[model samples]
Target chain A: MAESKKPDSSRRSERSRRAIYEAALALVGETGYARTTIEGIAARAGVGKQTIYRWWPSKAAVLLEAFLDVAEQAAQGEPLIPDTGDLEADLKLVMRATVDELNSPPYDAPARALAAESVVDPGLAAEFVGRLLEPQLQLYVHRLRSAQDAGHVRAGVDPRIALELLVGPLAHRWLLRTLPLTHAYADEVVEYALYGLAPRP
Target chain B: MAESKKPDSSRRSERSRRAIYEAALALVGETGYARTTIEGIAARAGVGKQTIYRWWPSKAAVLLEAFLDVAEQAAQGEPLIPDTGDLEADLKLVMRATVDELNSPPYDAPARALAAESVVDPGLAAEFVGRLLEPQLQLYVHRLRSAQDAGHVRAGVDPRIALELLVGPLAHRWLLRTLPLTHAYADEVVEYALYGLAPRP
Candidate 1:
């Protein structure tokens, strides 16, 4: 519902929710996941502890929702993967965007914090993959399925697994810091993934 | 370096070093990288805190050495990747072994701990990647270079980047727990990476 149409209380609630999200993201980025607490987030956001607890079950839940909000704001209603009947260009565009997003401080710090926590916490990891990551991955799956229909990708390719070939290298580089994550690296990943590493006959 | 030539004091020092390594690994696995401390490791290993400090400058250093020890034990002096004159087979063999290692508790728990820490700690991540991971990855570089010489791989391909296509997916799956990492999955990654996702003419 639009804020103008909503009651004053509902509008206030929306403002509070956004505040909470901002607080959570900022706190996690500054302090790291292990030290970020509900009380701390509440104090930072100028909201009551009960207000946060009523909305989210745990610190993880709050942080995850906060991350989702950040990602949505970053997306700004853009279609995640554009389909222009050219699979390579489409994938490269998305991958380049991803490279930019990863490099951006607003996304990178909080994401690294969440990812670090997820490695040790299976429950959080499951919720993260299910709630945030899988849905985003599904967009690629859909795009790849369209590619298969267009005879761009092979018929036998599993979209889920195939998508990883594109995303996995970027993630590996970003997480491990093995090398610089640049637009050039992103383009290389797309090209390498689409074409075989072996001598193409 | 043989124990037979060592004096009594040297032998005792060797035993204490082994104890310290075991204690560091077990502590990191049981608690986590953040909680695992020099004092805790020393207490667990039945050694003085000074002994740990004397040997390693920090917990990260100690844990890294411990990890190297575990990896050495796991390898059992076997070459990390065997060049059996079949690049695909060799890659698959190593990937499958990696799948098993990631699945195994002894390697998995401590590795997850170290990896989690590395995400937030750039210094540790650099050391982990440089001292431990890069050396292992270099084996693949060597194998791929050999393949290039044998006319199996494309001459233009950079083996370092090319190797990520194979290793990245497995690391992504293992770390994220997005899907079950298996020998079958490893084989598919090998096949898809070699042959590409697009159909051959």
Candidate 2:
């Protein structure tokens, strides 16, 4: 599954793309969203401005794709969202992966930088939610709906809101630095959420 | 109780401080965190750079105090944290008030600007979290502890982590633009959090 690529030209294109993505991530991590520009990215990547513009429409688009590439790599080329038969285990595994991603230096800095920038910039925020966050969230939506069909989750629950119960706490903890974002914390969130925080007989 | 007991010169200092605070907020809202500076605030408020420096150490400090003052006012002269005997009702009240403030023009724009700026800048973020976010969160911690005492929340529930269930969804919505933040949403978070999302008899 990993070796589905073609010949020499594709290899060069892949190399350029990887370089550009790394440069974009590093620049944003170093200089922030406002100061990281297309020109600067191209300069850092050893590509012309038109090279980047040909592939992506804007800096936001480039950065968004760069982040996706990073996430894809970190997932060990695993699909961005997985659908193992067990919904709770599947969700917990993904959330734990996310906690790991959010803690690691490369993913942590750039993602937080972009997310923080998006908090205020509505245009950038719209792009972020549309391209980056929502698609990933929709994977969970699909998973939860499947869970409902299988009777794992309550059929009455809004999958979107239900999904937030799982993801929101992690996102909240990561963004705010409120506490340690550990596998244990991720597992507890899953446990507390699936069983409910209230006492069970 | 709103009245000050300081002498004439100190009262003059108080007035200038208020003006500086107002100026800082307005400037940050208008131009965002990056563009806001002591010189602009001073110029807008018709105070000297020395005047701002005499009172606060940095632009972030000025903005922090400005936001704190606004929070204090929006609180309508109430305690920073409300502690009614009923825990759920008190939290619901505070979260609803938060929704109102987040939706209000007076608080929304400036707060968004500062929060966005803090995302990339660690120094600024630390200051923002320490001064503004943590103090407010402590109120909930105190209230939740009180609830633990009353046996409303589970005895083993960590107040800080538990409070996130209450605060996280709201913040997630507000920060991520995932949903319309409203009074209804606040009440829903309170319910979903205190009870569990799973089926309950």
Candidate 3:
């Protein structure tokens, strides 16, 4: 009977965790980050405030975890960019997927809310970079290293920096809303990063 | 006597405007955008709230114009990227200057505040891109066009899109705080954008 109770409690904990994540994302999306509160999240999730405080210390932590969960779900448990032996094709596929995600409503609002707050909050910015952005970027780093091994990428190129050439332009266009972020734009970014802008010598 | 009085009033108005710009910048820098208000700006500037409202519609407007004033001052009235006939050298110089400006305290704080707010605020983002970012980007467009004319850049490259390759990475680093933004980083971005990351065929 004690063993059965343990399993039931663990199952309930998992359900509560999922509910909290959903509530945090929806609340941040609807109200900006500055306005989102632990109370609001707890209420929306139909869990007690103590439930959130027991699990997370702050709103930023909750939002960061929520974003990470959403990103993981989007990647279907595989967060790495695919390597089809064609570096250019693989990058385009990943970039196009990024464009779609950025354009989607579910991801856009909450991500923007967190990103906005991070700009002014150095502590949150560091955590965001350390936990969310860096891990994803490392995936690109591994992909580029493989390309270098296969002679697809230049041997001297730093995969860390080279990946920026692909992702940076997309982030800029999306964040600034300077232009329409299209699949075509993503393809062009991949091509430009892979080929010389100067005429081939 | 009437003409002399007219000049005095105009001088007084100009002085008041400069004071307001300074106050707005300082306040926004000290407090995040959400906390900055017209009353705070007016008190700091030693003017009535009506003075600020008479010239600007809202706090966003006041902050935007203040940023523009600071940018113009930084450019010293010459806002165009220098055209030295060496495309790589010219780009590197401009990029390095940008890195310096982004690192400076006076520009960094308020700019971050505005950038943060713009991320969640679509209306302000549009105004920001339209009024500030696009005009500056056009300078890069003109320079890239000249490079194409001189056979320095491939004619097939679109100056507008190509310019993103230069500025985007720098901005990504600056906004995300993912890495140290240095002149060396700026030079490398120019090199990668001009030469490409893939090996020469």
Candidate 4:
């Protein structure tokens, strides 16, 4: 509210905000969550400590906001997956984008760090799941519900749990770093998940 | 090899071995993997540092062995899932055991700690997937293959990938602590994976 009143300083404030977000992401990636501090972020961003404090409450808040900013940027003003009326194709498009985003370095390092840290820190993990992840997942649920209405999906199957079949394998592979995640793999996941892994008699 | 030659001292060695395993698991659970050291484990175990060295090469090795011991003990001489020839029933039986084991405290804390660390450490994660996790996964593959042979599963489905559909969701939920892992949930995973989310013609 205070920032909007001073129109002249808005651009400079925006620049500082972006710098702080970038700085927080970089520092968290380099130092890991336990060691990354608000002071370090401030110094890296070339901003004063009070500037950081004026906006965010704690280091977790900064990192979470930084990640949220990165995610929003990744979306490029489109918050929801494109509903092309074809669930499989639409899913493939979004999953492909996800595969591409994960492949990119700008988001990978910080996202991976945050994910690793979240595993140990339950409070941060809850925030991450509730705020950052579950919203995206709910979008998938919406898409699946549309599919159910279209008779593409089995009506009895719960959209929420069914969605995990698509996501769980991808997430499992990503978190464990067990295998290479490719666009082809994403397509396969979409296919296998939607078409069924069993022999269709 | 060398220890087995001296059969006379085997009883005392067994006691120290059990104590060290317990100490390693406890310390890692309490302080996490990075802070855990051979000296600390030895001190906690009431054994000398040399004793740990004689048995395991590094902290990772100790934790790996400790986890393996816990897993083996959890099975209580029943290591492999029963090949009851009924694929669905067999999978449920095993997955239910997994749900119970994860919910129980004896192994939960240390296993969670190890999994958290493994996410950040690629080499250890690879070894974990290859040496420890894959062998167990391959057992699923074997069972799935038998199911395929019996015409219970679609022969075209890759048993390796199919197994992940069952294992991945459970692991994802367990790792994230997103929800209560129950026998019912495990049963659902087996059903959904086998039958899939698409309409069955």
Interface RMSD of every candidate?
0.7, 1.9, 0.8, 1.4
Model 1 lDDT tens row, B45-163: 99999998998889999999999999999899999999888999999999999999999998999999999899988999999999999999999999999999998898888899889
Of the pair 1 and 2, which is ahead by DockQ?
Answer: 1
Candidate 3 chain A: worst 10 consecutive residues by lDDT?
Answer: A1-10
Best by DockQ: 1
Best-first order by DockQ:
1, 3, 4, 2
lDDT by candidate, in order shown: 0.92, 0.82, 0.92, 0.85
Model 3 ranges with Cα > 4 A deviation: A1-6, B1-6
Model 4 chain A: worst 10 consecutive residues (lDDT sum): A190-199
**What TM-score does structure 4 among the candidates reach?**
0.94
- Candidate 2 yields a Cα-based lDDT of 0.82
Please, what are the lDDT tens digits per residue for candidate 2 over residues A1-201?
A: 454656777777888899999999999998888889999999999988898999999999999999988767776867755777787688788988888888999888789889988888888888889888888899888988887887777656777777777788898888877668999888777766776644555
Tens digit per residue, CA lDDT, model 4, B58-163 = 8889889888998888888985789888888999999999899988877777887788777777888987788778888899988989888989887677887788
Candidate order by TM-score, highest to lowest?
Answer: 1, 3, 4, 2
Kindly give the stretch of ten consecutive residues in candidate 2 chain B with the minimal lDDT sum: B192-201
DockQ of each: 0.82, 0.56, 0.80, 0.64
Per-candidate clashes, comma-separated: 0, 0, 0, 0
Cα TM-score per model: 0.98, 0.92, 0.96, 0.94
Model 1 per-residue lDDT at A9: 92
Query: Considering TM-score, which of the candidate structures 1 and 2 is the better prediction for this target?
Result: 1
lDDT of residue A171 for candidate 2 = 86
